[model samples]
Every structure is written in structure tokens, then in C-alpha cells.
Target chain A: MNQNKNALLLLTGISLFMAACGTSKTGLITIQEQGSFAVGGKVIASPGTFDPYKPTPAGQTFHGDHAYVFYQIPPKARKYPLVMWHGIGQFSKTWETTPDGREGYQNIFLRRGFGVYVLDQPRRGNAGRSTAAGTINPTPDEQQWFGTFRVGIWPNYFEGVQFARDTATLNQYFRSMVPNVGPIDIGVTTDAAAALFQKIGPGVLVTHSHSGGMGWLTAIKNQNVKGIVAYEPGSGFLFPEGEVPAPIEMAGGQMAAVGVPMSQFMQLTKIPIIIYYGDFIPEKPSDNPGTDGWRARMVMARLWRDAVNRHGGDVTVVHLPEVGLKGNTHFPFSDLNNLQVADLMSKFLKDKKLD
Target chain B: MNQNKNALLLLTGISLFMAACGTSKTGLITIQEQGSFAVGGKVIASPGTFDPYKPTPAGQTFHGDHAYVFYQIPPKARKYPLVMWHGIGQFSKTWETTPDGREGYQNIFLRRGFGVYVLDQPRRGNAGRSTAAGTINPTPDEQQWFGTFRVGIWPNYFEGVQFARDTATLNQYFRSMVPNVGPIDIGVTTDAAAALFQKIGPGVLVTHSHSGGMGWLTAIKNQNVKGIVAYEPGSGFLFPEGEVPAPIEMAGGQMAAVGVPMSQFMQLTKIPIIIYYGDFIPEKPSDNPGTDGWRARMVMARLWRDAVNRHGGDVTVVHLPEVGLKGNTHFPFSDLNNLQVADLMSKFLKDKKLD
Candidate 1:
């Protein structure tokens, strides 16, 4: 309250004062309450070897993944829960709270009348890694995001970039980021997310950025993934150079680095698919400029969508701006417009009858 | 700077310090230079009647609109200047500097290699009204905007809406607002904007909200209007009861006190149109919800786009979120992602070869 008051007092014009009309708490559920509604959380563990770099005295190589899943059960919840998958350099906490310190989408959806489940991928966030298999997984840094997720254009943010400028918001955003362990551990992450989805019963997959690739594989492997909303999935589905029905390869492919047993994109056709890309990216410049970064992701998404559709599957490649949203980063759920995006997702699920 | 430092000091956990790695200035162009460009401004005044409500001793009943236009003259300027039109409750200042204190689109475009022109609509902002036509405009107050602009559902913004919660941002936004004088003298407003376009030479129209109607009308009336980028145009264009090719109606139409005499919709098809809406609108709800506010705006934009396309016109409707932007407010240009959006507009203009 004091902070707000101080800010208000500092405001010189445009009437920073509000009547404190106080937002209505009349919803079926308020975000403040954790008990009245059904809430459950647990660490889904799996066995693995310890760090080879840090040798144990007893040669203790055995370890396990401590990925967490915290869910909020909405009243008369929909048949399928909403499994939210975070992106690279982030985890389930990404959906819990934003940098600006506002309520995350998990609670917003619960209020909007839908059950939501958030996942912490292995080796990220609250999730633990088996060993310091350093070389196997390349930890990502912040600079990569400026170009990849598009927090700003290359060279610098000041040069016409889109990241939030407020010091507070930027801080929150950076703080929320955890060092991302690359797709090298595709199996553990996919298995962890997949297991959570199954354990929670039938559910829809809501994947963001890097998790988008993982989510796709998990959805393919799990029959319970009623539908999929891949929001800016950065994983490029390697298209067969010449043919449409040729061997389709996904970064999160089942046999990818696992030595065996992988999920196939063909099986994904059983469920509805909607891929969302936020504003200004994957844009088609009239000059027919070369595709890369965001444009490439868009290309991959379109190809994957086309492939699925050609195979008699349901897929919708939604360029978000067409639906009316702009100035979003790779992390839309953590954006100021979080609720709006969540509302749209709910609408999509409702449309797919996945609810 | 002090406020920034204070905020940083207050911020806990997150490291707020930066290496000053000032964002890259190596854009297609840089926004920092002032000396290299020639800046000029002029007030275009036109005659009007005095307000009967507030009598003046000078018998100055005959008044005029002091519409101002600021032009940034860039070397090797593009074939067409970029004319920016502001929405209701705003003026040419809308393009000058956003509420968030960052540079607005005008500068962004100017830096992106385009001559930019902005207009102060008649009876709004710096453009003053002559007579108190008492109820001519009904001069809508703050409450009307809350629901109308989707700032929050009626009654109050305190409710669960998508408005930025921070007072500072809100203050800047509200401070930036100009009390709308309604569309009482839309002809004069459109004429003012149109005349400026002619004086400035050929240019693409970038209209926001209320100005969208004016931009459309001006484009139709002026041969110089090459194309249009209508961002979140909320004004509904009432299609003739049953006629497809009938004269269309626009909010910026002449003598629209209570009924018709509006322009035809077919004229709009002559030029390229791209309508953009920010996130969480034009949504298809599970509840089979009624349309109003942003939803209505979406319907209007779509109707206008479809009607134009039906007439063989080039048109595109962009829902920002689908393109990767989220958490945007009605005033996206004023939101945290303004530059991102400005960049997109610049890209569009570049693609159109307007710049």
C-alpha cells in the first residue's frame, strides 16, 4: 500500500488517484484462497546417476529428477486438466507469478472456471538434476533470449526492442528465469511432463516456447492429451526436404538421444492442435526476406501444421495478431496481458471441447 | 534516474544492475539523433462558430480549429510520408510521446527512415471547440471509457480486468488522454486530417481507434492516402439493413447526429487495409457470450475488412496475440510493448514500399 501510495504521490499529472473501487471478489473463486478449492502438489521423482564431475567418496552416481507439479482444482473442473508447459530458461513458476508481481495465469484460469496444472521440467527450477553431467546439457544464458524469444532485436534493447522498460518489471522477469538445461535431456523432461499429465488424468497440453517441443512429444506419447495449444513452440520439426509425407523429425523425437523408443507426430493427429505465435514475428515481409529466428519458428509451425492437416489431422496455425494481441514477448503468460491470453486459451479449449 | 535507482535499490532478489550494455543503436536507423533531421510544425486553422453556452465579450462566435501537424524531415525521405492519426480522447500528441514516457511511434517511424506527420483533430486536444454546443458531443467522461475501451468491465477498473495495475503507468496513460468531444464535428475533423495529408503529399495512414473512421474517410476523400494501418478501430460501421453495395456508414461520417448520410463502404476497397487489435478480444467464448466493447470493435473491424475484401479490396485483420503479443490494452501504443508494435508498423510500411 505504501509503495502504491508513494508512486501515486510521485505522479505529477493525469490524476494518478483511484477511488480504490477495489476489484470485485465476486468470482466463484478468488485467487487469494488456496484451501477452499482443491489444491495438490508433489515432486515426481525418477532415478538417474550422480554427477561424474563431482566424484562421490562412495562412488554414489545414483540420483533422480525432482520435478514438481502444483495444481489448482477448480470446482466441477473440466474433464481434462490444463497442463501448462514452460519454455527454455524457465519452469512452472513462470506460470505462477510474473515479473511485475501480479497473479499468474494458473489462478486466473481457476477463477475463469478451469483446472490448471503447471510443470517444472527436470534440471530446471524446483526440479532437480540427476548429476552435473555438465557437457551433456549446455546451460543457456540471457543474451540468447534477445534474439530467440525476441525480448529485443540484436545489438541491444534500446534499438527498437520490445521488452518492458520499467526497472521493476525487468527485474521480475530476469529473476524468474532459471538456467535452462538444453534439449539434451529430452527424455527426462518429456517423461516428467508426460507422467504428470497422465497422473492427472485426461488433460490438454499448453506449451510455451522450448516446452512446446517437449509438449508435442508428450502429447504424442500420452493418449490422455485431449488437445494441444502450442504457444510459440520454438522447436523446429525437421521437414523432409522434398516430400510432404516423408520422414518427419521433431527435436523432441522419442528416440532422440534416448538410444530407443520414441513418440511419432502421426499419433498426434488424434487430437486437435492449435499453434499460436505472438505479434510481429513470423511476419511475411513483402520483400520476401529470408526466414530465421521467429520467422523460422513460424515456418516450422506452418510446416508441422500443414503436415498434420494433410494427414487428415486438425491443426490451426494462429498468428496471434490476427486474433488481436500485440507487443508480446516469448513469455506471454508472464506478460501484463496474461489473463487475456489465458482467456483466449480457455476459449480455444472450450472450442475444442477439451474442457 | 533517481526514481530508477530507488526502484532498483528496493527490488529484492533480482539483480537490477545492468552493464549499461545500452541496447544496440544499430537498427535500420537510430532514434537518438536530432541534428541530422529537420523538424518543423505548423498550426492549420479553420473557421467555426462560437459556443453559445459560454458567451465571449469579443463576440468571437466565429472560431476555428487549430489543428497542428509536426513533420520530421528526413534525408532521402520515403516516397510517401507516414501520417499518424490518433483515436478518441487523444490528439497528435499521442504520437509524440506515450504515457509511459518512452518515445512514441512518431519518433520510432521517424528514426526508421520515414517522414512522419501527426494531426490534432478538430475539437480535441490542442484543437479547441468554439461554442459550447452543450450536448453536441455529450463529452464522454472517464467511466464511459472503462467499459468502452475494455480497460475493465463497467462499474470500475478495480474489477478483474486487464488494465496495468501500477499507478505510475496508469497515471501516464490517463494523463495522455484528451477528453473526446465526441464526433459532433467529424466532417471538420476528417477534413482537417485530410487536408494535412494533401499538404504533406502522398502518405500511408496509420489510424488508431476513433481516428480509424476519420482515416478511412480521409483516405476515401483524398487520393494521397495510399494505404491504411487501422489499430483497434472501435467505431462500428453499420452495414445497410439488407443492401450489400449500399452506401456504408462510418463513425466519422457527416451529420451523424442520430442517423445516416454516411459514405459508401466500397470506396474503402480501393486501398490496402490492415486492421490490428491487441490481445484477448474478438474471442469466441464457451458461454456464447454477447458482443460489446472490444468484441464489438473486433466485429466492426472484421465487417469492414470482409466488406472491403468482398469488393475486391486488399485487407488483413491482425489479432496481436496470434502473432505473439499478449497482455496488450486498448492503447497498445501506450502499453509496455509500444516499440515492438511500432517496429511492426515500420516493417509493414517497409514491406509496402511506402518507406
Candidate 2:
């Protein structure tokens, strides 16, 4: 009887271990709710009697200039959800699975018990309808984007870049670039983003690349943006009306700061802000325009940070290489080291009491 | 000793049962491989010395007219994957999830151990860059689509329509409409689709609404298309030379069939084809153009079916309401009763030995 009891105990232990293994392999996530909605668009009605039958474009109405938001809330979620906005030539897919088939920030944050809401800003991605007219010329500019995105110089990988170097992976990365159906209007986009904040209530705003400037404008427009996490903000840096800095000249073009009222600029100082930059940016200007352009952006970023901090604002700029985290591209959140990056983000959220 | 053995068995059984329940709740799916790629785009080089710095569109090259495909394969996937193409004014999101947050065809089919590939055809959705120029006017057209999609007449729901009647659900449904970055060119889209088939190799093609015509054209272009499943094909029906039917006049516009050589038309007869139409299509012309337009399409569909059958092809057309599944809209696969619709599709797949 004693031997049998010992055997039973061992058997139970083994069975429990097997069950635990099964759970990890499946990686099952429990989602309490998930859905999507649109906000902040105007309806344009054509002048004339509308006819359902024999309808013509001249006598039709259109609903556009709206932002679309898709959300998934885990059960018993945290106090605030993370609202993710994409950069130029991208949509919500930037926050989804990466080109290499790895989990993106959307699932990463959700797995950590925080709700994730992704947006397709007006005139791009799912929000492809626009009020303004713009032409999309079929220009072979992937090489330019490839260099600009810091994945690497065209046809060559930067030493120790975080992106997958396989042809298939590159194919996906290039294919992900989309075009705007209409000309990009900063005012229109910010208005739509401000509306998104109003609809979602208080939440942390996450912005990338071209959307960095829009984040500040949106936060100023609405008080619901409790915090901000910006990744490689390339343009649209805002300064007080009289304190705007001189334009930084680059090989491709010039980067100039936008000016807003001191009252509006002060709103940014009310929130905790964090900005992250990736690897390969030279400390000084380089001969290559692709690498040198990022160098200028970094200089501008520090200036932006100083401006915000002078006003008693909470701002922290992290250069991944400076912190010993290396090989990251412009898209650090979706790179191979995304999980480690996510952990760093989580720590900041906890420290700021934003999570 | 006997009592101890019995207790051990009970404990093991309970633990195993608990593990199974956990698996169901988490809905853990094991993905073997997943990624995306682009196919069939041409490179247009501009004349001049290309300058990386001070880049101008006049001295740049552009790549457009490509189809983007995102794919995932499950462990031990079925023999042939399903390549899903969306309709006009939409993208790959049509297959990801419904507006009401239910599983769309992508996940539904993925769960059944089949590989799934969703596409963003050239100049639409993710493949937004276009070789042709077009204007995207901000026209208020949601009500037009609302009625045309058979969800219901504007501001009302068709009796027992298989759509969520809540405001939020309706908001998402309307917001899903997108505009084309360029004019819709059948030749360009079909060429890109043919390239996708060549890359994927030996798969079933699934087309919805505006893409229904493209599916037939794609199959004719590539022998890799093993079968086709079309949902409410609006236009681009092909008949043999000298056998084109007279254009069907509708209140909104006219529906015309294209003429192709007998040799190319015969290619469609080599594979099995199935078509599905939803509710609210009148048997005869009605005063309401929205409903009447579909009636004309249905008539064309039968004519197309008869033509194919005459050429010794196997084709099946299913009207949901006629078969006791009522109140379906244009998007039956993503409707509230999507699971039931999936099962119906599965039955057809198995019967035709295409599973």
C-alpha cells in the first residue's frame, strides 16, 4: 500500500506537468471583446435631387474624412488601452504581425493584459476615402523607402539590422507600403485623430514615424490622451509660436518645426512622454543621405525634447544603441527584438502609472 | 492498493479534462507558417541621373500594378489552399473578421486545417500604388451601398436580415468602404492575379462581388486555379465569341457580358465552379433599383451557368433563401450566421472532392 501511494503521487505529478506543457504550446489568449468603429468624418451631399434608380456621381453623397478604429479588449483589462497609429505609407498593419511572421505590438500588449486599439487614419489604409483630391503616380520608390526606413541601404543590410534578410521577408516588407487615396492634410488627420481620442476616452497614444507630430497636435486638441509613446518621429515636431527652431536641411528635403500657441504647447508638458530611436544613425552627419537624414532627425528630436522639458514637461528620448540594445531599424516594435522592446515599454508604463 | 489506483485514475482523468477545456477556451491555434509577398508589378524607370539627395519624381523609378498576398498555413493543412479576393471598395479585411467581431472566412477556414491566402489586388487596399491615375471624390455613398448590399433600405433593416442592427455594427460596416487609388482596370488586376496563382500554385480561387469577373479571367490566364467559389459576381462575365448576351438594363447602369475566344472560354470548363447569391434579389424587375439590379445580375449568372454547363463544365448556383437559409446580404460568409454558412461551404467542398 505504501509503494502504491508513492506511485500514484508520481503519476499525478507527471500528468500535471504534461497538462502545463499543453497550455504553453497552444498559447491560448482570452479576449473578452473585439470590434471596430469609425469616428470624425463629414458627410458631403451632392446638390440635386437624389435618385436611387439611375444614380450618377453628380447626384450622390459621400461620407468620408473619417478615422477607423479596431479594438480588442482582454477581460479585466488595465486602466488605459494603447491606441496605436501608423506612419506614412502604412496603416494598422504596422501594429499587427510583422513581415517575418512574428507577433506585433498589438498582440504583445494584449497578451500583457492591456487592451489594444489600432487606427487607420483618414485617406489611408481602411480609411481610404478622402475629401481632397490627390494623384498616386506609379513611382518605383521602394529603394528610397528602404533606405529611408533604415532597414538598410538599398540592396544591402546594415550590419546587425534587426530585420529578417530573407528575400521573402523583404518582399513582404516592401509590399506592406500603401499609397494615400488623397493628398495628406495635417489638419484633417489631426482632427480625425482628436476625434478618436474623444471617442475612446482616456488612453495612452502611440505614434510612429510621420505620425509623431500629429500625436502632439491630437493631445493638445483633446485632454483624453493621458500619455504618449513615440517611435522614430521623423517630422512634424511642434514648438511654441515664437520659439520655433530654424529648419534642418537634409539631402532629400528640409525638416521644419511647426508652431502652435503657448497654451496648446503647454498641454504636452502635462503628460509623460517617451520617444525611441533605433540603430545605424551616425553621431555626426554621414556621406550617405539615407543615414545622414536620420542623424538630422535625431538632432531635431533632442531639440524638441529640450523645448518640452524647459516647460516642466516630462520627456525622455531613448537611443537604443546608446542603451546597449542594438540592431533595431525604424520599426523596433515589430522587429525580431520586439518582445524585449515591449518589456522596456511596459516598465515605462508602470513607472508612469499609465498601465 | 486498489483504492489508490482508482484515485490516481480519477485525478489523471480530471487533469486531462481540465486541459481540454482550457484549450477550447483559449482557442489556441498552431500555425505552421505565415507571411506575405507581392507579385506581377512592372518597374518604370525615369530618364535622367538618379540623385539620392534632392530626389525628384522626374528622375525616379516606380513599381506599381502589383497584387499583395498575405498567407498562413496550419499544421497538416489540406491539399489545396484557398486564395480569397475581395470586391470593389474593400480590401483583405473582408476575410479577417466581420464588422460585428465574428470570425470571418480567414479564421473560419484556418481553423479547419486549410491554408488561407488573402489578397489586396493592384491599386486597392494594401496594393494601393497604381500605374493609372484616378480621382477619389468624397461622395456620401454609404446609403447607396447600404441599400445595394441588401443589408436593408437606408435607415432600415430588411426583415430578419443577417446583419447586426446596432449602431456600432452599422458604423463599422459603412466605414469598411474604401476608394480606389486608380481606375479599375480588369486587365491589370487579372494579370496580377495570374502572377499570384503562378507563385502559390494549384489552389482554389474565391472571389466576392466585383472580383467575381476577375476570378474567371484569372483562371483562364493561369492553369494553377483548380476551382473557383464566387459570391455575387456583379460584372465581367465571359461568353464564347459570337455568343455574347444582350446587355441587361438596370436603373443604376447596364450589365454587359464580355466576349472571349472559344478556346479561352473553354478553360473555365476545365475546373469546377460554384456561385452564391444572398436574399432580397427579386425574381422579377422591381420598382426599387437596389433590389432590381441584383435581379438582373442573377439572370446573367444563370445565363453564364447555362453556357458553362453547355460546354460540359460543372457549375452550381445557390440562392440562400431558396434553400431555407434566409435574410443573407452580399457578404454571407461574414454575416452573423457565418458559421452555418461555412459549414455549407465545407459540405460543398467535400462533395466536390476539393477539400
Candidate 3:
């Protein structure tokens, strides 16, 4: 009986260990709340008597030009949520699960006890209703995007690209790209972002690619933006009105800095900002439009960085390859090594005392 | 020492119990696979020399008219995955978490060990690029949708409506509506859905509102459709060419049953099918267009049921009010009592042995 009791105890101990291990691995996320809402849309009323029973007459009103925000707050969340805004032709899905089924930044940040707010900018993705009309030409633009996104030329991966190279992953990646329902209006998008900041109140703004430029303007428009973490702001670098940098000529087009008032530009200087760029961007100008475009952007980024630092603002630009984290594509956050990249971000947050 | 050992063993046993309980409550979901892909889009190449280095000239090719599908499969999933397609002005968001933040049918069915495939039909939502050009006029049509959706007239909820009445919920609901980036082409949408079935293999097709008609056509188009569970198929009731019913007139316009060949119509008879209609749909046609429109639809649905039954098909139509489940809006799957609605679906699946 004594031996049997000892064996039972040992079994219980083993069971407890396994149970605890399993719980940690598969523990349910205790969510404080998760919901979605819209911001910055207007109602355009038409000149006719609206009737539900009949076909909508020419005078019916329209409610559009809005941005949509989906948010999830975990229990014991940090002080501020990370507001994730996607780039051109993308939606909140960019921050959700990656095309390869890996955890995206939304889940990654949520696991680290920070609330996450993913946005669909006006006239894009879920916010498809627009006040302005634009033609969505069924144009074969995947290869164009592939080159632009630095995923490498079609049919070939850049030697050390961090993106998943499997056919399934590639299929999903291409499928994720969506077209804008209306014309791309930077002002409307910026207004929506500012409105989101106003509604959510005091949050870190995270922007990718095309939205990077809008992020700067949003910070200037709203004081609620505590900080900004941008990944490859492809365009829309702003400077105080007479200080705009000379345009960097690219194979596609000329990349120029937009000029904002000195006061609005100074609002960006009030916040700590960090920028991240992935691999394959050459130090010098190259004939390959894909790499060269980014090279120009990086050069502009440094100029912007210097300008901010000169004004007593904190700014840091990280080239992943230079930091020993190589082979990252434009989308470093969704790359396979995203967890490592996230750690780098966490360190920055800690150093800046934002966490 | 023996006393201490007994105490330790008891503590271990208690700890094991707690861990097991915690795991059951909050265990992390082990996903077998999750990814997305597009199906059935034609590539329309413009007539010109394509140049990557220059502006997209007139000759650039466009990939449009495709449906985008996001799928998540759980380990040990049921035999057939649930293919969820949304209705007018909506996307896969309809099946995701609801406006009120409740687990939508996607997660609900996923938790029940069923793989879920959420689709964005061609020219709509995520699949916004289209071959045909259409206008998205910014229209204030939320009131029209509210009435048509049976949530009640503007600013008024049907007494005991199943929809969440909070302003936040209302805001989210209105924001969820997306305009078609191009024309609303049912043929194109049906073709894409058929292609999705062909790609994914045998699965149960679940559709809501507008897609309900397309679901029936999809079943006829592809043999991979194992079953169908539709919620409020507002239009596109199919009948044998010779037996097409006269169009039902409504305050809005006329509701018509599309005609298909008898051979194609017979395909629906091969699968087990079920339909659910929510509350506020009156039994008799009334002057109130909102209720009357649905009353006409319900009447048409019964006629459809008779037609299917006449041809030896398995079809069941459940009016929630008649079955003691009351106060449901058009979207019963995302209602406050969605779990109950899910239970009814589960029962049907069991009866049909599709699970």
C-alpha cells in the first residue's frame, strides 16, 4: 500500500507538469473586449425624396468616405494600443495572420499584452464605399506589385529573401492584394487616420508602405498620436514649406517631399519616430526599378531623419541587413523571422519607456 | 517526512486539477492550417507593350472577376468544411466576428471542429477589382438597409429585435456595408464560387442574403457541393425553365425566379438542404414594404420548397418564430442568440450525417 501510494504521487506530479505545460502552450487568450467601428465618413444627401419601397432615386443621400477600425483589447493590456494601418492595395488583413499562416503583428502584439487596432483606410478594402469615383481597371498588376514590394522579379526570389517561397504562400500573397474602390486621396486617408486617433485617444501609430506618408500628416493633425513606427514609407515625406528636399528621380517616377507648414511639421518632431527598411535595397542608384526606388526612399528617409534630429526630435532608421537581420523583404513584420523583428521593436519600446 | 510527502502529493493533485480546468477554459486553438487563395478570375491584357520602368501604359494586363477565399482548417475537422459566402454590400466579414463582437459563424463553426472557408465574391468586398466598370455613388442608404434587413425602420427597432441596439453596434453594422467596385454580375460571382468548390473539393456551401441564389447555382455548376444551408435567400430562386413562376411584385420592384434547365435544376435535389428565416417577416403581405418584401420572399420560399420536394429533393425551411426561436433579424447567425441558431444547424448536420 505504501509503494502504491508513492507511485500515485509520482504519477500526479507527472500529470501536473504535463498539464501546466499544455496550459501555457494552448491557454485561452482572455480578451477584455474586441469590436470595430468607422470614422471620418460624411453623408452626401441627394436632391430627391428617399423611399425604401421604390428604387433609389437620383436624389438619395450617400454615407461614405469613411475608414473602418477593428480593435482587440486583451486583459491586462498596456497603456496604449498599437494602431496598425496598411499600405496601398491592402487592408487590415496585412496585420492579421500572414499568408503563410504565421502570426501577424496584430496577434503578436496582443500576446505581448498590448491592445491592437487594425484599420481599413478610406476607399480601400472593407471601407470600399467612397464619395469620389475612380475606375478599377482590371489590369494585370501582380508582377508590378511583386517588383514594387521587393518580393523579387517574377519567377525568381531574391537570393536570401525572407518571404515564404512555397507556391501556396505565393498564391495567398497575391490574393491578398485588393484594389481601391475610389481614387487614392491622401488627404481623405490622412483625415480618417486623424479621426481614428481622436476617437481612440493616445495610441502608437504603426504604418506600412504607402500609409507611411499619411502617418506623418496624421501626427501633425492630431496630438493623440503618441509615437510612430513606420516600415518603408514609400512616399509622402513632408518638410517645412521652404525646406523640401530635391526630388529623387526613379525609373517609375520622381519621388519628392511634400511641404507642410512649419507648425504642422513640428508636431511630428514632438513625437519619437522609428523607421525600418528590409533588404535588397542597393546603396547606390541601380537600373532595377524595384531596388532603386527603395534606394531613393532610403536616402530621403535619412534626410528626413536628419532634419527631425536637427530640430531636437528623436528619430532612428534601421536597415535590417546592417543590424545582422538579413534577407527581410519589404514586409518584415510578416516575414518568418517576424518574432525576432518584434523583439527588436519591443526593445525600442522599452528603451523609449513606451511599454 | 511521510506527513510532508502526503501534503505535497495532495497539493500536486490539486494543481493538476486546476491546470486541466484552466486548459479546458482557455486552451490555445491548435490550427492545422490557415491560408487564402483566389479562384476564377480572367486576366485582361491591354493592347500595348508593357514596360516595368515606365507608367502603366494602356496595354497593362489586369486580373479581375475573381473570388477571394480565406480558409482555416482545424485538426480532426469534420468531413465537409463550411464554405461561407456573404450577400450584397458585404464580404467575408459577415461570417467573422459580429458587429457586437460576438463570435460570428466562422469562429463558431471553427470551434465546433469544422473547417471554414470565407469568400469575397467577384467585384465585391476584398475581390474589388473587376472586368466591368460600375459606379459606387456615395449614398446614405443605411436606413434602407435597416428596414430591408428587418432590424426595423430608421431609429426604431422592431419590438424585441435580435440585433444589438447600441449606437456602437449600429455604427459597426453600417460601416460593414461595402459597395461593389464594379457591376453586380451574378453570373461572374456564380462562376467564381463554382471554381472555388472545384478547387477545395467537396464541402457544404453556406450562404447568406444575396449569395443564397448564387449558392444554388454553384451547387448545380459543381458536383463538389455536398450540401447547402442558406439564410434568407432574398433573390435568385431557381426553377425549371418551363415551370418559372410569375414575378412577385413588391413596393421596391419585382422579385423573380430565374429559370434554368430541368437537368441543371435537378442537381439541387441530390444534396440535403436547409433554409432559415428570421423574425418580423409577416405571414400576410402588408402595406409596410419592409415586412411585405420578406412576406413575399417567404411565400416564394415555400413555393421553392414544394418545387424541390416535387422533384424528390431533400429540403427543409425553418421559420424561427414558428420553431419557438423568436426575435431574430435577417442575420440570425450573428444574432445575440447565434449559439442557439448554431445548435439548430448542428442538429441538421447530424441528421444529415454531414459532420
Candidate 3 structure quality by residue, lDDT tens digits, A79-186: 878999998888877887787878788777876878899998999977887888776665667766777788886546888888988966766676677788888898
Which candidate, 1 or 2, has the higher lDDT? 2
Docking quality category of candidate 3 according to DockQ thresholds: acceptable
Candidate 1 lDDT, A102-153, residue by residue in tens: 6677656665656777766655433423333321211222233444455654
- Output the number of the lDDT-best candidate: 2
TM-score of chain A of each: 0.72, 0.93, 0.92
Candidate order, lDDT descending: 2, 3, 1
Q: Of the pair 2 and 3, which is ahead by lDDT?
A: 2
DockQ of each: 0.01, 0.34, 0.33
- The models' CA-based lDDT, in order, is 0.55, 0.82, 0.82
What fraction of the true Cα-Cα contacts (under 8 Å, chains A to B) does candidate 2 also have?
Answer: 0.42
- Compute each candidate's TM-score over C-alphas: 0.40, 0.85, 0.86
Model 2 agreement with the true structure over B311-334: per-residue lDDT tens digits: 999888999888888989999998
Sorted into a CAPRI-style docking class, model 1 comes out as incorrect
**Superposed model 1: Cα runs more than 4 Å off:** A1-61, A135-144, A154-163, A180-183, A236-263, A282-291, B1-355
- State candidate 3's DockQ: 0.33
